[model samples]
Target chain A: MKLFTKYNRINLSVMAVVFVLSGIAYYLLISNLFIHELDESLNDYKDKLHVFIKQHNELPRFEFFEDIVVTYEPVNVALKKKFVLVSRFNAEEQKESTYRQLTFTEKIGDTYYAFNIAKPVEGTKTLTKTIAATTLVLLLAIVSGSVVLNRIILKKLWKPFYTTLEELGHFKLSRGYVPVFATAGIEEFSFLNRTLSGVMREANNDYRILKEFTENAAHELQTPLAIIRSKLDLVIQEEGLTDSQGLALKSAYTSINRLAKLNQSLLLLTKIENRQFAAVQAIDLEAALKEKLVQFEDFWNAKGITVTADLTATALKANTELVDILLNNMLANAALHTQQGGSVMIRLCPGMLRISNTAVSGSLDNTRLFHRFYKKAAHSQSNGLGLSIIKQICDVQGIGITYRFESGFHHFDLQWPV
Target chain B: MKLLIIEDEKDLSDSIRQYLALEQYTCEVAYEFESALDKICLNEYACIILDITLPNGSGLEILKELKRQGKEDGVLIVSARNSPDDKIVGLNLGADDYLSKPFHLPELGARVAAIIRRKSFSGQNQIVIDHLTLDIRDKTLKNNEEAVPLTRKEYELLLYFVSNKNRVVTKEAIVTHLWGDDVDMADNYDFIYSHIKNLRRKLAEAGCPEYIKAVYGMGYKFSIPS
Candidate 1:
């Protein structure tokens, strides 16, 4: 749930409870004041009656006034003076009405008489009801007003926070970009922005340093490797070398070559990760594949591996060098792994390419296939970086690649971006 | 022919000098940028083997200076920085060719030879070895005044052999030279042997003397049987 909605729910509920309790308390207080005033008038009326009886020295005539009713009863014993509330049927309105009654006993010329004075409370009750209805209407108006106001104001307040979240969602370490967060006026939001900026800056710095280290390490090894290779090339030319000695030299040469290729491959992977090849161009997929196949024709022919190609005209927009490496690695992988006298099939459509070669072994470990230095055969001469290079190229180019085993063939499917 | 070697690494420069010495080329060594600049300003050479990274300055500066001087010397850039940008920049700055470091020595020798041939001969380039003649321009082979048909790879292999004649060339070098280093056919020595066998048969059928010799487990050597 949104923060605004949650806050509004809690705020409005608490406001409603307070408003309702206050409204009931207010009605009770107002109605009690009205009843106290009516009781005061009733006592005043009794005092007036007593005064008149004393002044005249006889029973005064009973008269009805406003909503007050006065009555007298001669009793053998005097009754105590008190106030009582009673419900009585009214002849004028024909309905039950509440009244406040005052009763007392008085002796006039040796005869004790009981006097009762009562007043209807219908007006006070009606006033309290009207007040309560008005309070309820006011409470609803305040609650709805606060809800709308909080939604608009809180949305504006959290604008910077949401913007920061969106920017972080698109952050990429390989791009080496550190976003500059806008300064938020709110204290907590500003603090959050400052902290995130620092973290992103540090991450980008660390990434750049690591990439530079990889590139430098690869480059530094090249000169020595070249020197060793050249020295070996000259050493093997010496006359009168024994067969065993020549073989040892050849093995050392092969290892050095492998080392060189491994170093170069690592460097290339780093470059691709860094997005160093940024130049993009339109490439004719059919022409490029056909050209690469012709280059590999001699190798396939020597191994007696037949190739079949079903191609359509397809074009892709990507870095030229990366595309070339991608194609080279894919084709080389197919040729190297296919058994002698086996067949390799290539099919290309508008946005997909599939290459399937006769399986030399069972299905490979799909999870570890594209990992660096993942070799299917333990003693294979390949540096085991071909598939990794192909994978890296596809990832950087936004192409989808998958491997599968079917019909005794290892199939690699590539989905091109539209 | 004279060539200049501008490289910071002394061991590599010495090895290059030793290998090229067998080809009867006089090589001058410059271990730093100042000496390289001084040498280029003072003399003319058939080619200059330049390294991109030097002690005092970049070898690209030397290439730019050479172009500014308008000298006809061929330049072959050999750098360990295999980045495509460096290669493009070097070639764009008028360097004749760019060869990344850790390259096979025979490949280096071939590139240098091709640059020198292109610069000196001005398109009329040919290599005549006894009864065999190679037309570099047309990429054809002639055995005793009769044209011998050669496939593209076979012709390139022959040219590479003739460039570093009498020197043992590893099968690894030949494979990388023909199919490039990216092909990863290191275990396919049989393929190399077969291709060499075909070239030998074709040359032998043309009544040429046997020139290519397999050097006991090391590699192959193409030389006049002496």
Candidate 2:
């Protein structure tokens, strides 16, 4: 961001343009004045010579060079021309000594003749150096002036925006309130801030309402479900029932069990989304997996499934609860998907776990595998939240999980930091 | 053995009590927190089944009560809130183990049995099978002062096989229990076969006939012949 701003570059460029322009204007004004002064000095010198000639009412003399040597040549030329024109009346002995001549122009008149002189002005090196020095100094002044000016302008321009940002930065969940102040003379900024505050207010209101609903729903519905399952069990145990009736009750029990798992997964998803997993701990990944494997031995054994695990001794930075959920979900999914005589392999390396089971179905749409309510048509007991639970952990802990059905095997590969 | 059940739902508790009576373990129920606290203070139980949430307070509070009274030597926390937070909290508070709600009744029974063994015997320090007396602590097997030799996996397989004697332990259970989550590359049960063959060989060489027998595609079993 700071690189993009390039404040110094902008300031220097503006200052350079302003300084160059002012120097040009100053140079033009001073040069014009110098030319005007030179014209007046030359005019005075010419006038003095003209009066001197008129007083004697005679031709010019060379002795005039003693007083005004710089103008002698041009004045002498003018006086000689006047003598030639006046000599027609008195063919005087000779014209006054021709003093000077003008090479810039030709004299046309006699008594009132005109001469224009131009001297070669040289050695302007010092003048050029002085101008260069002054220009540099002016450039510096302009740069400093622009910086100061921009400071004032930017402060006023960004004031209300900064104020709003500061207030939002300090906003807390307890108050859920953001301070609003009117923007000064900026329609766009005021409109942007107004829209932001409006959205924040609405989001907070909706969040509070939804949070209350989830909590109420979880609390209210839990007991009734427990009651229904328990009543079903009691009915089964109470008296002798026909086999068909028993099968019907067992099917009902199975659906209830599925519903219960669904409820748990949904509740867990909500809790994770709500940021309610407040616990943190350094979890022993290998030890936790080993424990879960130990617990699941019977589940696999009863179905004649073979489990081969290579769980190494590595630790992870995770909350124990979420870690348990992630591992249990994966293990359960593997156990549910694999065939009775098939092999389920779990390999835990540093920061990665690959769980692969023999695929019962030929191929699967691996894409939507982690989505909620996803289930293989053959394995119907899946409540469809196993991979999704792992996903929730992935989202919260920055872990990554990928699934693939390849070469008659279903593989779930989870990766995280070592 | 007498057990105490601390659960929230009444019907669930009743069903659990009925099941335990069928299993021949005397049981008591405390559906509320205060009643649970009262029960823990009053009686000495072999095992306590606990639930996390209750109307009066949390089952975790009762667990603390048991700990304070210095009587929470054996307990299993049975909870619908099967989150690992509740499990670790319960276990660290001196619970013998934990089981989640909607669990199979047999699983609950298994946890109860494991906990009772842990609280009762501290896990098989010594065992007897036929003429062999195995001291688990010293890792020694003797037939009344004559030491028996066994390989590493053989000894482990022996201990596990005997521990689950008579029960038809499945191949997966043996693999998990014996291997301890280490062999994901094993494609078959050939490893178990070699270990069993070696164990049987060493036992027969020690002037004793084979006590470890294979039940064929199932699992190995250790028993004294009738």
Candidate 3:
């Protein structure tokens, strides 16, 4: 439910209950007042009859008054005056009408007489009925009018709040698109915009600083590494005396090479996370994959491994460099892990791409396959960031990547959106 | 050939100077921005190895100054930054080449030679190295006035060796120089060894003297006896 509807629903329901109860009370009070007035008039008429009888020592004629009835009856005992509501027959209209009647006993001489006076009161029922109907119409009119008014006026009143919400929804840190919130006339909305803009500016500043730190660290780390590599190059070229020294230098050189690669891979991961490469275009994925495989032909050929590809002509939209890196890392991982004389197979269809290779071991640790610096025990060639790079690419591109080992073959499946 | 090394790092500049000295290039060093500017204003060197980040100022300002003075010295940017924006900016400011940090010395020597050759306008397209003549413009090798068939990688490898001739080029350096930074050195030496063997055999079949000699337990040296 919308905020406006939810709040107004409760308000209107409470108002409806109160109006109904008050209407009922008003109807009862007004009807009782009308009946009480009729009773008072009838009592006054009885008193006049008693005065007339005392003056003339006889009862007055009943034909003299209209809508007022006076009746007399002989009784052995005297009774006090009392009023009651009774239905009486109308002689002129020839129908029954409700009236308030008063009865009492008055003694003129030795014989005792009972006198009755009555008055018609049909307007009270009509009055109560009209008031009840008007109350119902008034309640209904108020509810519907407020509903329409809320739909228009509340929408206008909350316009700034909705606009601010929309601006926040589209904000992106990577693109550095901060919203310029307009000044809201309402105090609360203006306060909200001011606070949110401050938070966004701070966030953007922190992000920029962090990104620069990563890039600077990479650059600083590379210079010393360059010196070490150059010195090692010079050392290994000198005239060697023994076998042990050559082996030690070779091992140290290998470690340095690995360190440089590790640094580069880590920097590349940071760049990917920072969204440094954002240019995108349509690319022939099959041709790109084929070119990468051809580039790796020599490495696989040295190990006597064969490659079989079944790539359909398909194009995708992505950053060209990212796609190339993704493919190169996948192919390198496959070639490095496969046994000698093993075969590598690639299958690409409309919505899927699969690369399966013959594994030297039974199965890889699936839990840690895509984690950084996670490698199989027997594989020393990989710096262990290949699959992690692949995972990051898939995440950035909104693709799906999975690994499965089945039927003596290790399979990697990449599913592209259809 | 004469060159100037405009860099902030002492050890890296010294190593570069030492390595290029073996190739018979005279070197001058400027470790700060002011010295670099002074040397460029006073001297006319064949090439200048410029680092983007110097002690006093940015190397880009120096590049702009060189262009303003109408100096024809070939500028090669050697920096630790690997961003495309830096490379693009340097190239737009008239740099001859851009090489990132931790580069192989042989590769550096090759780039320096190519830059010098291209900038000097020596009016010679062919480089004759003791009966193995390399047509630099056409990318072909001719031994004893006869053409020798070579693959792209083998040709590139031979040219690299010829550029840094008489120096011991390590196998690791060869891998890094031929294949790029992406290939691991320890994992692909067999491929390098095979390519070397194939290159040697092809040159021998062409009846050329042995130019590439394998130094025992070290690397390969490409030179003919004096």
Candidate 4:
């Protein structure tokens, strides 16, 4: 449940318990006060009767009434003046009624006589009922009103927090767009916003510095390698070189070329991880695959490998250049791994693309296949980065890539949401 | 033809100067930004070879200055940073071509020659190599005024060999020149041998002179009969 609802429920429950307990206490106190007031009035009426009897020197004639009654009895039955509540039947009303009675001994002529005075107490009960009902209605109104008012106030207070949270969700370090946090009126929420903005700023700065270092390292490394390659080009043109020298130069040349390729691949992988290429659009994947296949037709034909394509139209949102690179690397890998006269197969379906080729050797080690520089064997023709690049692309696009060996052919399958 | 080399690396600039020296083009070297800018202000050349990164300032500044002065000299950007942003920006600033680093020297020579041709030879679209004449605009080859049919790859190969006419072109150089950063260097060079064979056969069928010769185990050399 929401915090506001929880707080309101607890608050109202406590108030309800207190209100009920106080209502019972109030009923007892008010009823006792009414009974005390009735006793005082009965005592005053008895005193007035004594004063009248003294003035007349005879027993006062008594009158019968509906709510009050005066009666005389023998002196031995009543010892002293006292008040008691009793229920009596009244001939006029024909029902039992509660009343306060005062009894006292008074001299009439020669023998002692007991006098009784009674008054009905029905108004006290009505007064208490009205008071209890009024208190309950007022309590209910206060509890519900405050709960609603609290909810509205809290929602307004938390508006800035929600805004900051939403902006933080959309922030990307690679894009270098920092979120602008709105000022929360409350102290703690504003402090939280400031701390988060500072943290993100530091993180973004670190990421940019690291990215520049990578690009600079790749650039710096290429210049010297180029100089070496150019000098080697001149050395190879010299007159009369021994076979060993030529072999040495050729080995160095090949190693330098491999180094350059490795650098470029590493740079490209870093850029992909950092999201340097963020522009994406809906592209026809089947058409892109066909174009790549055309580019590789000659390479495969030169190796006597046959390409079989089963294309079903597929479109996905992705960076076009990355898609081109992805397809090129995959096809090149397929061509490179297959033996002479081997066949390559490509299939495309809705939300999926599958490429399979005949492998000259047994199944490759699945664990190390996509690791950087994890070649199948030492001195293999591949730079060992093609599969790694594919893995990175799949991760960025939220695509799934699976590898399997079935029917003596190695298969790579890629699937994504349409 | 005249060219200015505005690269920060001395050894690379020296090698470029030496390679282009064989093409009979006058070459000047500027090792820093100030000197490169000075050279641009003082002289007019067929093309300017620019390096984006320099010690004193950026090579892009030289390109900007060249444009600001309205110098129509062809600019070919050579950068170690093979970023698309730089390529796009350079091309937008009127640079004719972009070549990534560690490129083969012969490939560089071919690009410079093509740039010079595009800039200097306005309506002259044909390159005459003895009896073998190549129509650059149509991408066709003609010998003794008779059309010789060639595939796209064959035509490109012919242009590369002709660009470095008599130089000994290695299989690695030919592959790098034709396939620009695409083909794996460790793979077999048989593709180059096949392409060269096709081009030679087509030339011979057209009654052209035997200009392309295989130099033992080295590579092929294209030249007039001696």
TM-score of chain A of each: 0.80, 0.63, 0.76, 0.66
What tens digits encode model 4's per-residue C-alpha lDDT throughout A65-103? Answer: 434688877665436788888999766768888888888
Model 2 clash pairs are A59-A96, A60-A96, A60-A97, A72-A100, A73-A100, A73-A101, A76-A100, A82-A110, A308-B184
Query: TM-score of model 3, chain A?
Result: 0.76
DockQ, each predicted model: 0.66, 0.09, 0.40, 0.37
> What is the lDDT, from 0 to 100, of the residue A341 in candidate 3?
95
Candidate 4 regions exceeding 4 Å error are A1-214, B182-186, B215-218
Better of 1 and 2 by TM-score: 1
Which structure is stronger by lDDT: 1 or 3? 1
TM-score of 1: 0.86
lDDT of 3 by residue, B56-95 (tens): 7999999999999999999999888776678889999999
* Order by TM-score, highest first: 1, 3, 4, 2
Could you give candidate 1's per-residue lDDT for residues A312-356 as a string of tens digits?
A: 999988998899889889888898899889999999998899999
Score candidate 3 by TM-score against the native.
0.77
Sort order, lDDT high to low: 1, 3, 4, 2
lDDT at residue A343 of model 1 (Cα atoms): 93
Q: What TM-score did chain B of candidate 4 earn?
A: 0.95
DockQ (0 to 1) for model 2: 0.09
lDDT of 2 at A317: 82
Instruction: For candidate 2, give the docking quality class from DockQ.
Output: incorrect
Winning model by TM-score: 1
Residue B87 local lDDT, model 2: 83
Error of 4 at A279 (Å): 2.8
Candidate 4 collision pairs: none
